[model samples]
Target: MPLEFEKPILELEKRIQELKETARTTGVDLEAEIRLLEERLARLKREIYGNLTPWQRVQLARAPGRPTTLDVLEKAFQDFLELHGDRAFADDPAIVGGLAYLEGQKVVVVGHQKGRDTKENLQRNFGMPHPEGYRKAMRLMDLADRFGYPFLSFIDTPGAYPGVSAEERGQAWVIAQSIQRMGRLRVPAVAVILGEGGSGGALAIGVANRVLILENAWYSVISPESCAAILWRDAKEAPKAAEALKLTAQDLLRFKVVDAIIPEPEGGAHKDPERAIQNIKEALLKTLEELKGLSPEALYQDRYRRFRALGVYQD
Candidate 1:
């Protein structure tokens, strides 16, 4: 199903299809009319997607069929040897990590993995990691540091699991540990916000030398719906809260929260997954190339300075 804001675009597309079918079946020459509608469609896409509000971008980030971490691993990298288990407890499916080759350069990749449907969502816990998940991520970071491989992380979770079981197992502590681990890694690290990037779940693996986000992705401490519920006592006020939170990619880029924005295909990533993943591949390779010359100590200092400079205020 198309999102509410996308209905107009889809309706126009449907009309164009109908006209094409009519012309084909009735042997009518509608080439001129079809060409006009095609031109209008291109302009409509730019007008709508190019001017998306923060809330609309959020909707796009959460849209169904948006490419998942596994999808990127498959399409953007090669020879992904998935590693499981945190070595302390059972492995958490919400977080996935492995060794992969990016344009023939070995790297360690870790990310939150959401599912495609309700049954799989339940199994993946809606991409909300538990303590073990963060631990697993830390394990991968350690591997990267040990082998001098660059680290790549994908951020795409609503938040860490908040249930009593997760808490009992030390969710917050593990998250903090993961953030500290990523910060201290000697290898170059880069993180991309593929989707939601909500709260500690995203940040646990997100501390890196360069943080990038997709054009339609968002990164925030809390989701707009949750913020609206808390601030306005109504979830329906999420659009207003979204504007106030400044979580969109453009907003984050303005604030220097993200280093760069990878442009998505028209409509959204789900509309053209291959193009979106290819964009990510190019960005990652370019960023890694930029970081290639820095020594390990230089990389550490670079990351330290980058983060220490965040949120600086002027009187």
Candidate 2:
């Protein structure tokens, strides 16, 4: 389904398609009309996608059929050997981690995975990780450190699970531990925000030397709807809240929250997932190469400085 904001473009495209089909069947060249409509379609796309607001970008990040972590694992990496179970409890499908070969260099990859259909979403908890999920991520990071392999994390989650059962399992504590573990990792670490990087769930595996985000992805301490509900007592004010939050890639780039912004295919990653994944692959290879030159201590200090310099304050 096309998003509400995208309806105009889709409608225009449909009209252009209908015109072309009419010309094909009737043997009358609607060449001039089709050309004009095609030009208009191009401009319409540029206008809508180029000037997307934060809320629109958030919608794109959560767009149905947008590439997920599993998609990247299958396409971006080679010879993935998935590791399961947090060792203390059952495996959590929301968080996937394992060994993978990136351009022939071994690395540990971990990310939040959302299911494509209704059944998968129910199983993956809508990409919201539980306590065990965070634990599994930490274990993967530990493996990366032990083998002196670079750590690559993909962040795409709304937040950690907020259910009573999740809390009973120490959701907050495990997320904190995961954050601390990422902070202290001796191996080079890179994190990519593929889509909705929200709250502690995103941050748990997001503490890395280099943080990259997709052009339309968003990363924030809290989701806009939740922020709206907290401040205005209504979720309907989410657009206003999203504007205030500064979560979009452009906003974060200006704030230096992200190291680099990987451009997506025009319209969004879902429109051309293969190209989008290739762009991410190129960025990852470049970032990993840059980080590989530093020693373990240097890598740790680099990560420390990068995060420590996030916000501006004056007294």
Candidate 3:
């Protein structure tokens, strides 16, 4: 989907078409003038995308064409073998994890998968996992560790499913188990917040030796809207909550909540998804390489310190 700012650019292109039609109809020479107008339109698009506001960035991150978890798997992984089912109950499409090859090395890839359309959205629960989904992640993660394959998780959920079925299935317990298992996993693990990383749904897979986030991806304990609802009793106050939550990649990096921020294309990742995937692939390769050198003791020490060091008071 095109950004609202792109509407004017599209309108300009339409007008350029009208000019060409008028020139053709009247037998007038306007080719040179058309070229000039086209060049100006292209330059205007570049300028508009160069300095997008935070909210606009958010809109782009959730855009329909924005790269999904499966899209990244296709671009960044080779020989992916999808593993399904929690082994205890039904398979949840909201969380997908399996074996894949990254940079010629075997690895486990897991992520929250959102649907591309309305019917699929209902099927995937809009990327919000239930207890079984988290349970499945734990099973895959355990397999990765047992096989000595590094783990990579892409977080892009609004939150875990809060419906009665999810609660009945022990959603909180499953999420907590995932967090504990991920943190204690002996193999190297990296997490990237590809889009909205909200609440425990994100945190379950987020504990890692290295955490990367796209420039526009937001990670927060509670979503801005949720925070606004709790604090102000108005969802319309989300913008203010977003500002205070400091959930943007830049803010999280500055606060030492994540290891690094992956640069997205101007106008966010949806602008050019291949480039975005390339950035993530490069970051993941670099992090995996770095983690390979660390001993188990060092990995545990540093990972523990990384979490403990957050929220430190500095005067």
Who wins the TM-score comparison?
2
TM-score of each: 0.98, 0.99, 0.91
Model 2 segments more than 4 A misplaced: none
- 227-262: candidate 2 lDDT, tens digit per residue: 999999999999999999999998898998898999
Local accuracy of candidate 1 as per-residue lDDT tens digits, 188-302: 9999999999998899999999999999999999999999999999999999999999999988999889999999998899999999999999999999999999999999999
Clashing pairs for model 2 are none
Backbone clashes in model 3, listed as residue pairs: none
Question: Global lDDT of each model?
Answer: 0.94, 0.94, 0.87
| Every candidate's CA RMSD | 1.0, 0.7, 2.3
lDDT of 3 by residue, 1-315 (tens): 566866888788898999999999999999999999999998887887766655555666678867788889988999889999999998999999899999799999899999989898899999999988898899988898789888899998999998999988899999999999888877888999999898899999999989999888888899888899999999888878887887778878888888899998866788799999999999999999999888766777767877877796768
C-alpha lDDT of candidate 3 relative to the true structure: 0.87
Give the Å error, residue 185, model 1. Answer: 0.4
Model 3 residue 1 distance off true place after TM-score fit, in angstroms: 4.3
